[model samples]
Target: MSNQHAKPPITTTNAGAPASSDEYSLTVGPGGPNLLQDTYLNEKLAHFVRERIPDRVYHVKGGGAFGYFEVTADVSQWTKAAFLNNVGKRTPLFLRFSIVAADEGAPDTDRDVRGVAIKFYTEEGNYDIVGNNTPIFFVRDPMKFPDFIHSQLRLPDTGMRSNNMQWDFWSLTPESAHQVTYLMGDRGTPRTWRHMNGYASSTYMWVNAAGERFWVKYHFKAEQGVQNFNDAEAKAMFVEDLDYHRRDLWNAIARKDYPAWRLEMQIMPFEDAANYRFNPFDLTKVWPHKDYPLIPIGRMVLDRNPDNFFAQVTQVAFEVSNFVPGIGPSPDRMVLGRLFAYGDSARYRNGPNYAQLPINRPINEVHNYNRDGPMRFHHSGNQPVYAPNSYGGPRADPQRYGDPSWFVEAAEIMRTANVAHKDDNDFIQPGTLYREVMSPTDRDHLVSNIVGHMSQGVESFIQERAVKSYWSPVDADLGARVAKGLGLTITA
Candidate 1:
């Protein structure tokens, strides 16, 4: 036999035990039933069967890369975050880009919102900005989030997604109009992940060194410039390549054509939120640039592709509640809901010690009383497991590091809609977007996209109601155009 056909002298092993023959299972005779003593075969099959972990409930079809965030302008006055303090300071970060409303098997070019989650390994801890490509969302309150996602997913009986269900939910929830407007436009079908922008759609609180608080929104403007596929183009690309966006990102980084984004923040003074014309914390609405202009603070460049896709990309998790010093959650209902949900999801999917995973671990040492669970690779080594011990365990330092919190008004815990501000109606901002922000071409595309989606498998009553309640409220022209396209007539 040729030298290439010969096996190496080194023995192959299953776990730590040497396997005598990998190609054949141990048996009583040549053709006898494979014996139960074939422990190596059992081990191989067991490992293979248990390989896959639970996929994320959302944003499952995605890819990620390693990068660094460099502070370009001084932001110390607004935030005391160590990662964003000094000019030219660089903090390592990982960015995951994903398509919402789809599983891992779905096409990347689907007309869906993209998830843009970033994890910054700061000196303090892991800071994550769990956001999406769009600046706003379908619902303001967390109570309606599950319903909205359910509407987007397949129906229980038919197991097929229905536009009627989606329209019905949107028509019932007026606040969804703003996000619906954005979705049924060029912005929904971004040409590639590299060509789209990301927004920390939820409002967050930034505290300065002097304990002054501010409400802030994060925007990651793509340096490549925003580009998108029209409805027809998006459909065509789905047939061309299901993983087009993932491939584009990987190829670009491999060839040293790194993607970058500038970090711009819209910061409202803590007191200004109380008297703003509209609710500043509303997730379904955006703070007009005129009211609070974007202030550039830093830039992020994804220069390194993951060496192992599963180890770094799939295993990496970003929790919305993972805030370091100087940052905390705002009063946004969705943000508050996600503060618990994201971390809980990670723990359930990745085990109780998910933070101990290399991708999720912070650069700094973790010294805490929390002890072992499944896959607890990191141990404290006889350290006290409870706090307030005299054996020199880690102690809380209230003097040096203050809690990132603020004062709240004392009120009765009654379930009610958010306290409204002047000009807080759902239709105003969306109407403004349709009339003032969108260009003529964009307006046409938006109308077409809406008509195309609503005309597919939607009931006539749902269609009429959507045209009258949602589209008309957004803009009269948009409503009329959509109605005309859908062959429906509405009374003035």
Candidate 2:
């Protein structure tokens, strides 16, 4: 085992100068009046009135709460992350739930994909899981993200959203079958944020204490149990309460009816991924439970609501790039893209010192070269900022701390599709979802939802293409039923 105390005692300040007893403010001898001669006084006062930065673009309408994630089962063999090392360990966390594509004033009952983001304040650093309410996503590649969101947003000519635009994009992109199926089903309109499961939809890499790696996916099953509204009920909810989900979450916590979720992981041995039945990293697919069953590791309960909505809820940021030791990203293209997009979004919304925000700040002390932004507060007194200088400064300690990364093949860079594995067809799992997973009542609701949404102003050509090319490939009956609902004939 590597030595935890590999680095020598901190002999220099973060600014790279000799350390000193600067913990106290300069004052007149013992109990005399304080003097301005102490330059430390000025520095202390400045940090006291620390300025705040501006904040957001997406997940606009949301609610969140403070919670603690308690490890239920020991997972030390799967990950070396300190928070997951010991059973009964409780790590403070903040979870935010949101409705994607909805504006700040939009009704929470709208049928849309829900965003689930969790930030774990671990001993090492902040580990974030920025995911969605569903296990699969609409597109595998990040290149199609903006286009997909645009299709869901309001049209340019008239500031009103069009279902035709959505169906057109989904029909053109066949890879979206699985997530589209989930969306057009009863799951789309969750009864409340507390009644839906959350998934870290992208595959990730986890390293054990032995340095062995594995491919992993995260699922947070709502202990409240999954509940949702059918198409008509969801529509009626809009008229009943615009903020139904948000209100329910707040009131539940306030009344001591805490919402909880059980954390489960589907882990695949690292070497198995190369020859897996399908691309394990595909955002549009799921690794069947039969192959790698879920291992329940922890339980998260949201027992405390945020005091201020704007500061703790709206301003709270979750960067997908935030990874603690023993856990890192995978080859999933969407995950790779998000590693940059999410953090950059935070910097743009909240200034470069966004991480310094109270909600985003880690529980442990942060010592790094990151300095001098809009609302800069902390300054390493008298220490040089740069590293590798004669002046002592914090340096990388790979021997003591493992990098949250894996060995990558040095392949030639080029734009192409992800490598395909056996049984990699996009429609396979969604077809299984329709045929096997969904109950008879669930299937009826799915078909009805699809028909209800697609029948609204979709072009005849798009309707035919969706039924024949998209839904039919997923399942013949599904395609035919959707077509029958649209009063259209399926080709081929």
Candidate 3:
């Protein structure tokens, strides 16, 4: 083909072999049968056939961007992390926002939980702050997580999600009260991903260079201000545009109306966990800001949009287990459970070499003995695959690169309650949120949302049980109001 505007080279196959006309397939004769001898056509069809990969079981639909995290304040006294060692330092990061408990096909405007997964490619390593829009989650224990998520999904026989199953599970599990309140309130239908704050609300451990350990929590407060839509408004908006949230994010970054968040934290001494008013590691609970006030450290800004949406947003993996120096896991059951689950799920969905993918590859050098798996792109040249080799293999440094270690009593192995959690009741935080935290108008909206969900296709007995077991525990007045609105009798 002759062209005035000269390109670098002619079209080629995936293997760099010069390609011919891709319009037609090779055949035995004109319109007889396709020939396997056409390697170019075969390669194209095979690649296209296996193009799609398995999506996340949760947080399947998402929007992502590349950006930078700037250290605005210093916290070197608390953490030995190199990224947080100095003020005015910047770290490259990729952030992904997604809707929970839904497939990729679902609408972005669905009234569901949103996830904020940010991967910080710091010099130390890739640290993923996998969090959610809400400060707390529904289930405290990892054992209840799968069952809780199952209720929100399709039923075995009918294959349709039932409100009865969802409410029934929540009513039975009292620990879910706090998150349920957040979910049914106006916050559930956030205006857009840019408007909701992100949280490392789960407790984590931070150890300084001096071998001092402290419990910490992170909050990314949205600079754009938190906003939400009422039920009426959300329904109307969904009808007009189902991908409203995704479009809002892509357009916002494209127009340079960049969104930003302040990264703040709550720090408590390691020994303080024993006598804290609440279980500090509970995922269903929040550390009161009054008791543990926020301390600003850094800020995150998303200024660039991804050129390839599928590569950056869909394939980018953020595991809960990815931790770097100066940071380590806690006794939080949910976090512990996810440490295994997140990595395992990613391997299955993205293949074993998923980490080697460009979107997931760390900018810093990655040297490991892990070798010989499917799709392995990098094999260190002529290096011993095992450790303890005389050929200059990388080795762990206990003194230089060690993580902080804390002692847990031998008797703490079982599920039995200790003195700290003996009287740890689930109703405390949700009640405080209802009675003292929310405004009068906010309470009204919360009640309205609860009634609307409970009133849908659920049996009268389950409805009554849900109100009495869940809502009544939060506030008797709220339970009574919900009963009245649902036209149900309030017995006992």
Model number with the top lDDT: 1
**TM-score of candidate 2 on Cα atoms, chains taken together:** 0.88
Off by over 4 Å in 2: 1-56
lDDT of 2 by residue, 160-271 (tens): 9899999999999989999989998899999999999999999998988988888999999999899999888999988989999999999999999999999999999989
The residue-by-residue lDDT of candidate 1 on 284-338, one tens digit each, is 8999898899999999999998888887888888999999889999889899888
Best of the two (1, 3) by lDDT: 1
Off by over 4 Å in 3: 1-9, 417-419
Order of models, best lDDT first: 1, 2, 3
Model 1 TM-score, all chains together: 0.96
Stretch of 10 with least lDDT, candidate 1: 8-17
lDDT for 457 in candidate 3 is: 85
Clash count for each candidate, listed in order shown: 0, 5, 0
- Work out the TM-score per prediction: 0.96, 0.88, 0.96
lDDT of 3 by residue, 52-129 (tens): 888787788888888999999878789898888889999999999999987777777777899999999989789999
Which has the higher TM-score value, candidate number 1 or candidate number 2?
1
